[model samples]
Target: MRSCWRSAVATRSSSISRPRPIGDARWRRAELGAQPDLTAYRLFHGDAEGAPGLAIDRYAEVVVVHADSAAVLERWLPEIREDLRDFASAYVKVHPRRASRLTGQDMQQAAPAAPLWGLGVHDVEAIEGGVRYLVRPDAGLSVGLFLDMRDVRAWLRGNARGLSVLNLFAYTCSFGVSASLGGARRVLNLDLSRAYLEWGKHNYRLNRLTLDERDFVYGDAFDWLGRFARRGERFDLVIVDPPSFSSSPFSVTRDYPRLAEAAARVVAPTGILLAATNHAGTSDERFEAWLQNGLTRAGRHGQLAQRWHEPSADFPLAPGRTHPYLKVRALVLD
Candidate 1:
């Protein structure tokens, strides 16, 4: 009996349980009738073309849809838009289903016939806080907000009280808002796109945060960080969230190392650093190794707090479904 119990315990411990609705169908039915809060409704499963990459986001009454798969592009279009209206207001924003040059032709071929479907292209939404702005995916290369970073934003809000916080690659400055709301006296948001920065400003205004609350700088992250170091400008809290690849001036391969060096300079003694890389090829071990090297070169050793793993709701790892590409890892520095 003792051996059997030990085996059972080990089995349970080894498995990762996913979040699911309770067994009571009535309770689930009740929830289905009501619109869920933002955090609660993180994913929308698509069935058109029977592909897995398509997803829809319901922002209050606004529906933002993305189709990243050729299969989905071919099958679901106007139908998907109508289905989303059940949750959204009246407007539905649709982005092109282009993935790579390889899929560009396919996407165009599978495109919907006319504008009668209420599908139209528009500029992405920008949100601002303190010194940062976030260009959300609603109108840009991808989804505007990285929802997985919700915890990191929460962490900033809790610890950034009265301190100056710096947000690097501040896509939409969601963290800046959280930190501002948390009581941070000043915040700085840095990004490369003027369009995204403008959108971010809108988000800040929507939240009723003031310009004095944050600063938005549009330029290369490395140049800004280096200049910040030279000017003796330091931040009490720094959040680094970078994309894996860039087609424009900033490439992670050519830039992350320099950014790390600049971060070391601007980081205060008691200040905290949050560094993240979302490259699917990058493993937790790789992130740790790179950070260790960066810290060593900076002649400063910081503690690695926790590793945050983000699993996509669109593609959950189930019986046969595979989610081998997406990776999100964060290292907290002290």
Candidate 2:
């Protein structure tokens, strides 16, 4: 994988004209196809794979092409669709540079409701490490599961046996599902959106796991963490994976330390805390500092157990970058 990254960097420096052709992406796809159980993965990482601002992901029989702008989508979509002809459907999603200024409706309008090529099927099941996840290709910005978090989910599935897991900011409860499947004694998912919690239930059902209504909690993560701390309820494993930026107090840059402190209160002594963020601007050193500050303020001593990054096969780091946009750290609290 390091060779892949270096080669990509070399290719970038060597060429100044047309971007790499779809054949390169096709080669990567063929390599990924060897894994029978996994059906969802990034086929092309635009930032590192010669196609800037353009990425392609495959979910089961569906292929999704993400372009940073309308022009990028228009430029690469046809060739990508042709290159991935084995897929049943193909869809395009445009991400404008000034998307932050656009309203929700405006963003939705940027993506087509129907497939740009092939069948009209939108809803599909994506399998990763033999776990089934419901994915809708035509659904607005995200398709239920975050492909970059695939390795994290797989790690949880292997390590959660007999542990009581608490998943904070559990969008669609993917972590909860993975933990439950790994034979965790109990798993509680807390999120701000009731609708997303319900969607999480659907994910649980897709895996044929029994769903307990009490396990799905809908509320602000900070508020719930406070309540859990007050009630003296602790978990053996706590997962904190929040969005990079949200309204007001949920901003990662400004509030992650507070969130980490609150989350630490509910982690049992000797338990593991897995904190993750996808903010590209925040370097790893600063993120670890934030975690240390929060743990020190909480009066808990801990050691860094492990660090996880995005799968390099699908998410190669850009030239000279030491880490990807996604950063995950595991701390063992004493």
Candidate 3:
């Protein structure tokens, strides 16, 4: 009997459990109705929401269950499916683990997440701060949108009026969309991928925002920054948010301090600059220090206006955590 009890305990320990909800859902339900307006938000965030290796995000009536380990997702897929029966569609993706080559393979070969139930679809609409953006489930790597940047978009919506905004390293141009929606005079989105820029244009159309050919720039942001500086081009607001690593010739990899210097050059004399990164291992203080150093390199002094935090209550960080995996600093150039 002791052996049997031990076996049962081991099994329980191996199995994945449901994650806790983020605070009260009453406000979310009231704003979005019974089903969370995934266009805005719904579901769990890993570590933050009590599910360490798993996260479930809702896009309107569709659900996207993202897991750190595919095995954990596979083990609990059935329970997840049944629980999300009311959702119009459901999808899943395995986040690539970069611990080692073998771990990377494990993530790549991890059980494919198909539509467990409901009409399995790839594309969906999600809202951030009242602005609509398109999200594609199971897309290579990113799955379309970075949900954590929700507050950055919110900040832009509130402050982009009559200003010219430059979004450097703009993935799908989410910041540009926010600036446009917030009545920016001109918003330029610069990225390395033409495909992503085209998709960004689709997002503009989805939100009924007008688009000009020049608004979507498909080139290296770093190269363009130099040219913009030489041409005396300046923007009231400049955002520099680069991926942790990139092989692209023009992209900055792990060297965000250098990227920040390039970013500050184009900020208008009395403009705002937002530099952010999601690089793991770098503490919050270190990241902020890098941005500060970058400003100094550009011969510009920056006053910290506000360090942007996640606006969505759903993204909870560990209690009293200072460097919570993501860092965004908003500074005003002097």
Candidate 4:
């Protein structure tokens, strides 16, 4: 597959034709499409914040497009439609400006809900954490799935069966879903938002799993971890995927190291701990230091297992930009 993708890209490049050859964007698209699998996976390359607010996703035989840019809707739609004619079936998902006016206390709070006009229908099967879920993309800031964590999820699912799992900073409980699918006997999800916990329960329901069996604790994850330590509760597997910053009385930078310390106390002797961060500005070494120091301060000893990367080939960070999104590193105490 790698060679095929390389060849597909190289076929368009020529050293003999001119002194300097211009790279074609179509070749990039072809490379993206010629990956391991392209079913139910599509690509869209338009500015989300700029003039062109165009999005395209393939669902079954249909290709859904959302044209929020006026110029693209008026001028480029015909060309885009013609180019996409060979791609199964195509349809437009409109995101009119007036239909998406969000008003709240602040700009961040005023932003419209995530589903912003691209196929408002619910229950799309998005793969994450080795589980296929009927998720609603428009539900919240999260699309019910974090496709970016695909690789990390796969690794955990394969290794976590029969383990007592703890998922902190659990967003719609995708990791818990994957852990459950991976045959975990006991799973605990901790989050501050009860609404999101409810959504996580819905996601579990979508997979025909019982949430009552697994513990869903609604409280500050840091506080819960401290309580877990006091109670001498231990887990075999722990996944920490927290947001960059939250108003939930817990700031990541201020709270992450403390969280790591708490994690070390609750982790079993032979357990595996995953401390994942999406802060792209922090280097890999710094992230490792933070975790290692926290564990040491908490009087826990663990060996570094592995540093996981994004499963997809498309790297999200530009080299020049400071991206703190480091991969999830697994630490083994055994």
Candidate 5:
């Protein structure tokens, strides 16, 4: 796909005016229809797919749009909704304005959000790669599921069976859910938020999977990593997906090499580790270097088993780019 970053200017007879690409409408529709299990997808990737300033997503019957530029997004929201109003409802989320310049109080006020049309519902069920997950349409800040991690979830399901898995920074335990769905013998989800972990339990329930309180842990990932390292607790597959910045007692490492070192300590001698960062600024090469440095610090001569990236059709990328905002790298510790 070509770069969709055109500066606020109008598309010259391009699909931008239509929001969801008319050219790919049939293909998009067919893709969504064919995959009943994987319902959530990028109906239109704003700025990158075609519609600048707007990112249209589907959660089963509901459609969610997140736009960075309300000024530009406002004009197309209606037409976009009308052209494809066959389904349920529609919603739009405005990007928080120039956060860099906003004061702390001002920062607290988030971007505006409202339902454009259709029935606005919260309780919605959806699937991805045949895996069931919940979606809360009212979560203007988030749509419950991070669709970009679709490939990562699939990878966990395939590689985690029969292995003890540890998912750190597990938001809503999506990775853990996928691991259990894939048959992981022992899966542990650790996160700072208890509410999300509880939500994760709900997800487990949806899949008819058993849940142990011991398995769903609540704490700082870094702190627990230290405890697990000292206790000689090891996992065959360790997943470390951290947010950009963490607050309170748990401060995430800006030092990538240090993070890698901490992550390796919890991995079994013959284990596989998958670490990812969603920070768009971090290139794949830079992230890999951090991973390599972590291995060096840990004194573990690990092989770069596999490198991962966004693979679903919805999260398309431009050519000649190292990483598409979200970067993931996997390794085998020897």
Candidate 6:
């Protein structure tokens, strides 16, 4: 009887010990095709990959594991650390489903201050397409940069030459930095958070780009857009990438059309406007309709120059899903 019980326990342990097949094939492909200077990317997209409630990202020497709950994070963290043994450090960040109910102390308790594996090195640099941006693995919710927008930044770098660019909702100004590197004549980064604007300046200095205080605007995007329109200021390239939901009066479902109309007003004739949303609930058809309505209201006619979705290789859609969460369209306004 004792021997049988021991065998049963062993069998269950063995079954649960194996690591989920995450980052194996993807890492191999990345290693083979990766540029020498690029170092940051999504190692595992949990919802689409084998791991349903967890995702992993690499930033230089550190690896961040994001989970939907503390229990899920703790359960799989050991296996993930073993699987990514080559990484210098690993940190786990739990995003509770009902975050609105939790207090600051509850969140702090959920995500411990210490690293799960190796030394606690929170701050690091993430290089993508040869442009460097600062990242903090231990930062709550989001580190300085959003890995999913890597392709969009790359596109801006390649196409922004000689254009005057305006980047709205510029968290840390990653898009502005990309535009600067791409040789844009001028780049204006607008955001509600002054601290983020300062961080953007640090990014500019990191790339050895010149600093002009006027270029970093600190105000609400809607107000600034109105002011720009009144002042007859226009941009050759306008980027509108607002958060899906924010404390401000912005809701992707309800306000996207209004936002689009405001953005279209400041686009120079024949200029390019890149509008994007990462709201999984909003369908592509609905999003496009909102853009069309906004354009029509603003009296601007345009053609969709390019439509970009999330990079499929790294961010594949989950099972039974037809489209990825991110949707971006570049319109050439006339």
Whole-model lDDT per candidate: 0.54, 0.82, 0.71, 0.62, 0.73, 0.82
| Candidate 1 similarity to native, TM-score | 0.69
Consecutive 10-residue window with the lowest summed lDDT within model 4: 18-27
lDDT against true structure, model 4: 0.62
Question: For residues 307-331, could you state the per-residue lDDT of candidate 3 as single tens digits?
Answer: 8655446666755556567778889
Off by over 4 Å in 2: 1-20, 97-101
Ranking by TM-score: 2, 6, 5, 3, 4, 1
Highest TM-score: which candidate?
Answer: 2
lDDT per residue (tens digit) for residues 1-334 in model 6: 1232233334334546553455353443354135567677777787877778888887877878889887778777666865666677877778876554567787676566688778987678778888989887766667788888888899889999999999999999999999999999999999999988998898898889999999999998899999989999999999999988676767789998998999999999999989999998888999999999999999998799988888877677899887778899999999
Off by over 4 Å in 3: 1-38, 99-113, 249-253, 319-322
- lDDT, candidate 6, equals 0.82
Q: What is the TM-score of each candidate against the true structure?
A: 0.69, 0.90, 0.83, 0.71, 0.85, 0.90
TM-score of 5: 0.85
Which candidate gets the maximum lDDT versus the true structure?
2
Q: Higher-TM-score candidate among 4 and 6? A: 6
Ranking by lDDT: 2, 6, 5, 3, 4, 1
Off by over 4 Å in 1: 1-41, 45-50, 76-85, 89-138, 253-255, 311-315, 318-334
Looking at candidate 3, what is the lDDT of residue 7? 33
Candidate 6 TM-score versus the reference:
0.90
Quantify how close model 1 is to the true structure by its C-alpha RMSD in Å.
Answer: 10.2
* Of candidates 5 and 1, the better by lDDT: 5
Q: Model 4, stretches more than 4 Å misplaced? A: 1-119, 128-130, 321-324
> How far off is residue 283 in model 3, in Å?
2.0
